[model samples]
Target: MIWQIELIILVLVVLFGFGALATKDLLSAAILFGAYSFLLCLLWAIMGAVDVAFTEASVGAGVSTVLIVSAVLRTTRRTDH
Candidate 1:
């Protein structure tokens, strides 16, 4: 049962990662990346690493995602290259 839960989280993380990479919109990609981080943090928590999970949840899901989205909003979505 525990392994199954881990597998599900792993699959969700992979899907979110792919979605982030495939998305054309910077904001959408940032949101997907945040989702990926949330899933990873959940997996870590389930695996008994509470401190690491807390850090990942706070920094990755909360701070990093918000910062990335804010940066995207401040800049152009299109790349010159």
Candidate 2:
């Protein structure tokens, strides 16, 4: 059961990675990156690295996402056309 849960999280992280890269909108991509980081935190916690998971959750998902979203809000989401 634990292995199955880990497997699903791993898959979700991979999917989020691809989705982040594929998204054209900066906000959407940033959100997908946050989701990827969250899944990565889960993976680390499951692997007995709770400290690393906590850091990843707080820094990667929280601070970085907020920074990215704020930057996106300040600027344009679309590229030069």
Candidate 3:
């Protein structure tokens, strides 16, 4: 595994994590979380953990993301002053 690629992925994961936490919008946060999960899947693949990578891609990035987005979409976004 190339350290350079891994390092780049790591940086992206951190950025996505912070983005998810910092975003005020629920949909944006969910999307960022999905991206973070995808990045983790890539890292796992690079580390030779194919099974883990597949699970992360399918469950973490795929199903989880969809569920989050759906839930976000169904919720009201109004804020009380």
For model 3, the superposed segments whose C-alpha errors exceed 4 Å read 78-81
1-81 per-residue lDDT for model 1 (tens digits): 378888889999999999998888888899999999999999889888999999999999999999999899899885444
Clashes of each: 0, 0, 0
Q: Using TM-score, give the best candidate's number.
A: 2
List residue ranges in candidate 1 displaced over 4 A: 78-81
RMSD of each: 1.8, 1.4, 1.9
Per-residue lDDT tens digits for candidate 3, residues 30-78, read 9999999999999999989999999999999999999998888888542
Task: Tell me the deviation in Å of residue 13 in model 1.
Answer: 0.5
- Candidate closest to the true structure, highest lDDT: 2
Give the worst 10-residue stretch by lDDT in candidate 1: 72-81
- lDDT: the better of candidates 2 and 3: 2
Error of 2 at 16 (Å): 0.1
